[model samples]
Target: MEAPALEVVGLGKSFGSVRAVDDLSFRVEPGRVTGFLGPNGSGKTTTLRMLLGLVRPSDGRALVGGHAYAEHPVPGALVGAALEATGFHPGRTGAAHLAAYAPQVGVGRERCREVLEQVGLTAAADRKVGGYSLGMRQHLGLATALLADPPALVLDEPANGLDPEGIVWLRGFLRHLAAQGRTVLVSSHVLGEVQHTVDDVVVIARGSLVHASSLSELAATAGARTYVETPTPERLAELCAERGWTCAPTGAGHEVPDVPAAEVGAAAYAAGLELHQLATRGADLEDVFLRLTGAAA
Candidate 1:
């Protein structure tokens, strides 16, 4: 089956006097992982709910392959979602739980076993969900999402209760799903994990879109500042400012915005300023996330 793209256009939701999501718009292209991120109470959940048709939107639309989630003839075949790992019944065994939902998606019992094995949950197939570990429960959630072999996936914090090893496994699994040309959108507050897992990012705060861009672009934009250490800090700062560089004095050294280390070193040497250290203080995704979200607040 061909992979489907996800699009949310001017999506919004409100409850009484509060607006949970406001004019949010973003797209998740096929064959890549797009991370949905925000601070607590930032409407990430509300947005995802609207996307999956679990919540009625006050305005706009959420579409997969040019159709709303529930509009598809076989929505399960179009997209699979695991919004919460605790959705399973405690009394039901893992296999039994999946088997119960298989027919609803037009799959047979065999598909349950296949997904259980794929998620490494075969050994715990008959174990009650109440007896399962958090990681094990997360695995079961993933198995449920994979049951129909859908072309797209929507997961919310799939790594929340995972161990270090489980987190690693999930990263590879999501990447593999995207490699098969499936569109994947995962929401998580763990910016470090999302940094390595996703190809693109959509960040929201206080029910509004704050930023949306590819991971590389965000990193590059955040890392535009370089650090320079010189004995004549004030002199170097003046020199940089005269050259049209925005230079600021930092605790460790001087920060020159958008100036390369090579250029800084050459200019400092020409000005006879002894440099002790000069390097680029490259900003990672965490830096970008914090700055954007903090500003949004």
Candidate 2:
């Protein structure tokens, strides 16, 4: 197997008295999209900063293809990252904006046009950034990241202002990058935002690693469940305890994992309890995400 495109080993960071990222470890392999997930202020940005060598880590290490990010002869060409999308000069045309960075990225001015087209921003290339819509600015940021055609990508909240249609376009674009064997790591606070686009997930909360696994593995771990909504939740709790079944309240309903709908209905009936609603459900991706991160709905 190929070596990981990105790796974090026991990574940690501190801002004086406060801890930011705590003992996190994960690997981003080539040819896949990895979702770096957590709620707001969960150290997602700090972790990314440390990985890019923008912030010094207090402990451990963050590596890009086996070396520290700054160790590469041309780091931008090895790993393209876009941590923010709004720092452009208001008066600069999008094409000129990329042209200024072309020399820094060791690419000629023509590369800017190619990336603008690659990110579907060719039509807007001549427009000043101040007049661009948020989604268009996002596309420009992506174009900038692709300036050198890097084999690895790290994007933070890349879909912040995208409309539904723009989001759909981005999904296809990121998938295309990964299909070409580039490693991709994207961060977001909402699981549903990038759920369909990612192949794996790494979740963190309060600066600590919570869960990290393949998306399919996480789904399989959640298993199947029967969702039941009844007024007498106390009685349903009893039935679950008696059956040695683990259960939890999933908003309006109680989800009994690994238990069939028939079993739950039969148990409620046998106990002479009233069930207003009962149905079989596959594990909900967002529900599992909330549980993994211990985040409130």
Candidate 3:
């Protein structure tokens, strides 16, 4: 069967006087990894909870497979979710935890073994979850989510505690899942953190949707800039200012933003400034994200 799209339509939630999520909307389609990004306390978790039916939304609808999570007859088999990684009994072995929840997912112990191996936790299968590192715990949570072989996945901070090697593994693993036509939505507090992992991005701030677009689209709209090093920095900055370009201070030199490298180079050469080094800086996803979500402030 084809994977179903995950949709949030004007979703909102209020906790008495405070609103957690406000009129948010976006879609996650199959065969792509979508990064759900926002700063901490920006209602990312609340929005996800509503979609998973863990929390009720006061205002709109969160749908999986064209139905609310509660409406699905077998939601687990349709959308696998690993919301958090610490929900395990301290004394229970990883394998044992899987065994305990296997019935709830309508899968037996054998399926548990398969998912354990799939998430690279086979060797640590017998180890107590208490002894598992945060990265291992993350893999365990993912293994549990995969137990039912769901077509779409919703993971919150799957890469949060991973080390360098573990992060590389997760990036490849998520891409593989999407390659298999699964709709994958992974949440994080920063866009640059998941910049290379996702095909699309949906960003929110203060409980409201701020930006939603394909990864490439976001990059294209970010407006690449030119970074240049010069001995006469003041002159270059003045030149950039004259041309209406914003020259941000950088470690090596100044970053003339929103202007092409060729244009900057011509202007510098025309002004008789000796260029020590010049390079084009690609779109900085984190910078763009901060500006969009107002987190930079």
**Candidate 2 backbone collisions, by pair:** none
TM-score of each: 0.86, 0.85, 0.95
Lowest summed lDDT across 10 adjacent residues in model 2 is found at 1-10
Q: What is the C-alpha lDDT of each candidate?
A: 0.88, 0.89, 0.90
**Residues 1-297 of candidate 1: C-alpha lDDT, one tens digit per residue:** 698888899999998889999999999999999999988789998898888889999999988888888988888767888888779899999999999889878999999999999999999999899999988888898898889999999998888899898899999999999998999999987688778899999999889999899988788777567788887788986897679888888897888877778888888888888889888877756877888988976
Segments in model 1 whose C-alpha atoms lie over 4 Å from true places? 225-258, 267-277
Residue pairs whose backbone atoms clash in candidate 1:
none
> Compared with the true structure, what per-residue lDDT tens digits does model 2 show for residues 1-297?
232389999999999999988898988889999999999999999999999999999999999989998998988888888888787998999999999988877999889999999888889899899999888888888888889888999999999999998888889999988998999999999989998899999999989988899999988877788999999899889989999998899899798988989988998899998999999897788988888788522
Model 1 deviation from the true structure expressed as Cα RMSD, one decimal place: 3.0
The Cα error of candidate 3 at residue 205, in Å, is 0.5
Error of 2 at 9 (Å): 1.5
Count: clashes, candidate 2: 0
lDDT of 1 at 268: 86
Best TM-score among the predictions, by candidate number? 3
> Looking at candidate 2, what is the lDDT of residue 185?
97
